[model samples]
Target: MLSLFLFQISLNRMIKTLSATNYSIEIGPLTESSFQDLLTNKYAHSRKVIMVDENTHDNCLEFLLTAFDDLTDAEVILLPAGEENKVMEVCFQVWNALSDYGIGRNDLVINLGGGVVTDMGGFIAAVFKRGVDFVNIPTSLLGMVDASIGGKTGIDLGAFKNQLGVFKDPVAIFIDPSFLHSLPENEVWNGFAEILKHSLIADSSLWAKIKNYRNIDDLYTADLIEAGISIKLKTLLNDPFEKGERKLLNFGHTIGHAIEGCMLETDSPVSHGHAVAIGLLLESQLSNNRGILSNEEFKEIEETIKALYSPIELDEEQIAIVLELMKNDKKNSEGKIKGILIHSIGHCTFDEVFEEEEIRKIL
Candidate 1:
């Protein structure tokens, strides 16, 4: 009986892997009318609630309320905005709000802000009553291209980032570029880091296109957004469970998360995508040093990234501290500091492990 059960579980995983590739990713306008279109889809229930932040509530909720106005009943739960709020405490607040609303497995949760709202909101939905359905209506460029599409949901645990979470995808996602019009310049740059990372991993052509996005408005185009989205979707389809191929997506994330976490300890806080971009540069150099990528390829990546991002000037002490944090990344196994590195501009993955002694030397 045990053998048969294990076999069934293996078969189920295989089926899910296959199905993810077959799934067609949808990208279009996210408006009041889109909600009506979503209502036509098959689901367990129509009762849905949105979890948003202060800025999103002010800029988007009023307009969104009208979108769901015709539904039997829909509500919004607003939280404070910014990365500081992505904690267990905020997760509890959202869970309490959902409980008060009498939300159930049949109901759905909609994440309506940037990475913070989506990450925390998705975590709440994943744990509420064991598990519940949710949707992602990402308002920020970062969320639309990366966070909103991936099912990895979690809240930060103290100095560590995304230390607690589960892989739970939403029922659907709505990507509307119009919402990005109000985004700050830094935030737009933060999102671009992921776009660049996506390009570095699989699509050289996409990388070429991204290099041409000189200004923020360049990212607002549907073609650019769709290209970035397609790169991620294709990767996810190949490695939905993140056991192998999908790990490549973390090209800059390993050190990037650590740097962001370390910086948060001080007065300055680095956005997730920005930190990852830095990670990509440093790690790419490391890859070159290891005889992986050619010098020319490494320089091209560094030059392009530097064009958009000004590197953080860190002292030896700061670099050392951040490298220590990388040891605790959730992706590592048994405390081994495994990370994704590049063989070339368009090829990267998590096949390399950095030694603590060498890491210390680099810092």
Candidate 2:
């Protein structure tokens, strides 16, 4: 399910924490009664850096700054928003600012924005001064459910998605759903794609809830958000480095990332979630072709996705381009693209290799 909580404060909905391999994900409001005091007391004397994009700086940062007095003296580094800005050049600029601010290993780096901010901010903290403690306050649903949870920090290389990255868990992850208010309607649905991905790969119950909702407003609850995080975290803790089962999470990402890369220079680029939605359709069809998923289940998956996401018709030329981009996917090994094939809506197999010809046939 594309589970989301409403913007209004729910007094009865107590704060929830989801455990990861090392760090804990806190889903709740920023208040003195919650985990706020623990954070303030822990880093009261340490130098702090709050990394944000323009959107979060203007919208979410104030709420955080107001709630935590420990960050009163923290430096704010604002970068231009969007995936295009997540690059080496921006990292260099942020590195220079950190140097100028006299930040050191003991200081904390708080990433405060969407996926781009969390991905790149975590990377900066990992590389600077050989490694530093940092926390994530993901302001977007994408960051909250997937990007900010896995400890996989990355930045795009040229048009490729997450081509350069490091595996470094943040000190903690605080997800305050109130930040969703700053997002446009499209951006919110973009995150919905990941939730959909999680549901298809592991949680049939979530999928059952997801397929029933024709409107985004129908799904709003924090516990469902925790369920999505728990699904990803369980697989990640078992395989932190993607040596095995973690590949299950990459179900739609293989082709989805290629589509994202191919559209990078286009007049209109597709969002990550939309791109993944397309990949899900293609891969599930392949599962049926390979005699894994049942045709009945495949039709259900297709109908549910088509109801929410418009089909992105790719031309022969565009298909050729994405095919080439898929060749560069990190999961590819032995000169074949790697993908996860599903047995059904909630179960999948990992490290299923496909020859270029087989993948081409599907395209």
Root-mean-square deviation of every model? 6.3, 4.3
Give candidate 2 regions above 4 Å deviation: 1-13, 32-35
- Per-residue CA lDDT of model 1 for 98-154, tens digit only, reads 888888888778788998888889889999999887777788889988988768898
* TM-score, cand. 2 vs. native: 0.93
Global lDDT of model 2: 0.83
lDDT of each: 0.77, 0.83
Which regions of candidate 1 deviate over 4 angstroms? 1-24, 32-34, 40-45, 71-73
Residue 186 lDDT in candidate 2: 75
- Predicted candidate 2: what Cα RMSD to the true structure? 4.3
Error of 1 at 202 (Å): 0.4
- Counting clashing residue pairs in each candidate, in order, gives 0, 1
- Model 2: residue 227 alpha-carbon error in angstroms: 1.4
Q: Residue 310 deviation, candidate 1, in Å? A: 1.9
